[model samples]
Target: MRWAACAAGVGLALVPMTGSAQAQEELEEVQEARRTLLMAMPGTPVSSIWGLVGQLGIGVEHAVGSYVALVGSVQVSGALQGTESLLPGGSGSSGQTWGVGVDPGVHFYLTGRAPEGLWVGPHLELATYHWTVQNEYLMGRPDVPLSEGDLVTVETRSRTVQYGGSVRVGYTAILAPGLTFQVGAGLTALSSRNTNFGTPRVEGGGAATDVEGQQLLGSGFGPNNIRNWSVSPRMTLGVGWAF
Candidate 1:
């Protein structure tokens, strides 16, 4: 009878052990379900080959929910500095400018809760610009007057810094795994300030050098506005990769 009692006690203890094991398994399933609901899709990082308004950009996305994510990107242009100026050929001086911009926003995915499928979002962008132009002239002929060996040359440098914000909406469609195509547009408003400087060499005939005057003479190839603001449209078409 003592042996029988010991076996009964052992069996009784096993009851709670089995119940506890089942409960632990149930808890794990619940936690997994919660994780799946909160993060329907995994987070992905993205980069663009071509950007809106002729820029190159890279970005990342973080999933907060099955249908929502946060996105951010940065863009850069004019990497090839000292490029030929838009000015007419044989301007003696060359011109070049560079710009950088950033974009931040949130995204909503319709098909999945990640950076994939058709997504729409609002973004803000800010950018700045720097430009310079240089020229040398001998005043001998209207055309081809300035030879390669001119003693006196004029150099003009101008810089315009602009800050702008925009409201953007876009749709991203997945082309293949980790690849996407995006097309979007933004309404942008910008405020800008411009500064100019010029240095001219004066020789013979008592020529008066117009320092400030020469600076204000824009060749119509760069930003010539000072303390002005404007509103414009921004558009984008690019291919990107998400991982």
Candidate 2:
């Protein structure tokens, strides 16, 4: 009877140990699943190669639920312009442009949990840009003597605001424990409004239309006071660390 009782005591003691061990294993498994990622985008270099607008940015993704993740990014972009005047003896023109933007979206995983596998989502974007153009014109007759006011300088400035959205489909791969790579494709639609500031004057003291100024300086040199809508395709590639 004593031997049988000792056997029972051993079994009871092992039962609690086994249960504790199982709980610890489950906790470790949960810890191994990554829920957040930090990413760096190579979008700017690719876009520059394609002669398209490009952005430099940092992004983040966080799994909020089993099947959903939230993603966001901040970006900055810029372009430079130089053109020769359309008229003879016109010196030339130059422009400086810059912009900033933000993008935010939600991901719905189809084949796996949040931040993994294949996903589709909708994203929104907001951006603003500023442009400045400087030009010089030769107003005096080539055969006659020149005066101090014979050379005229003109400056034009404008601001533009854009808002848009896109629908994207992508796949994210966890290459290693904490390394991830992602690729995505999408269609984007955007609407923008531009406001031109300051009046442009030529040598004859006559004011020039914004369109004419833009053309004479350089076609598409600066933003105009028009509302425009456009649709385009977008591609993205990123490498990140997951935690």
Candidate 3:
């Protein structure tokens, strides 16, 4: 009876080993079968990264069939714009900014697959732009030539950051496989919430400008040009890649 009990225990242990070997063999067979299938096909490279994709991508890829693909892309930009006074360039009339910006947005397409060609879609863009204050300076001396007796020297500085959203309708121009160009502009709005006007050191005071009623001191992305509910015309251009 003792020997029979010992044999039963040994058989139970061997059953798990046998099952494990069978499972490993089945796994190997599935892999080699995939390789054999790849070899039988013409001109397609086999990749090790195919297994996870086969299991997951077929369910989520829009190109495969009806699926909701989560698509995302980045917008790289360095835009330039010139402006006129009513800003913060002291008494200067015009200025410019090397506007740097970044925009990111998403779109949902009503299609059963990753559709191609002139497709119009609605998009919302969140963008941030920075304008370096153009230090508008007084050429030589004051226009009135304050005589050297009543000269007032002033030092000032300014900068601006603008953030806003836009609703755009555009066609994605496919230049090639996986590459696209986006160009469109319908409706746009912007508001720069912060605007500052200051003179760091207004030396020799008493030099007063006899001008008033909304005089733009300089042009940049700062105050006066933009405040709450300030509306300006806008344009949009972008490029991206899809993988």
The best candidate by lDDT is 2
TM-score of candidate 3 to 2 decimals? 0.40
- Stretches off by above 4 angstroms in model 2 are 1-33, 42-53, 83-90, 142-149, 199-224
Best by TM-score: 2
User: Least accurate stretch of 10 residues (summed lDDT) in model 2?
Assistant: 42-51
- The Cα error of candidate 3 at residue 40, in Å, is 41
Pairs of residues at least 3 apart in sequence or in different chains that clash in candidate 1: 66-113, 93-134
Clashing pairs in 2: none
Candidate 3, which segments miss by more than 4 Å at Cα? 1-100, 110-115, 118-153, 159-161, 175-179, 197-199, 203-226, 230-234, 240-242
What's the ranking of the predictions by TM-score, best on top? 2, 1, 3
Report the lDDT tens digits of candidate 2 across residue range 145-193: 4342245557777778889999999998876567889889999898988
Q: Candidate 1 vs candidate 3: which has greater TM-score? A: 1
Report residue 75 deviation for candidate 2 (angstroms): 1.2
For residues 1-243, write the lDDT of model 1, one tens digit per residue.
999999999999999999999999986554334311111121111111122224566665666776787876666656222333343433244456566767677777767436545666666666665555444443332343434222334555665566767666666654433455666676877777776645433332123324333433434335445688887776755565544
Worst 10 residues of 3 by lDDT: 35-44
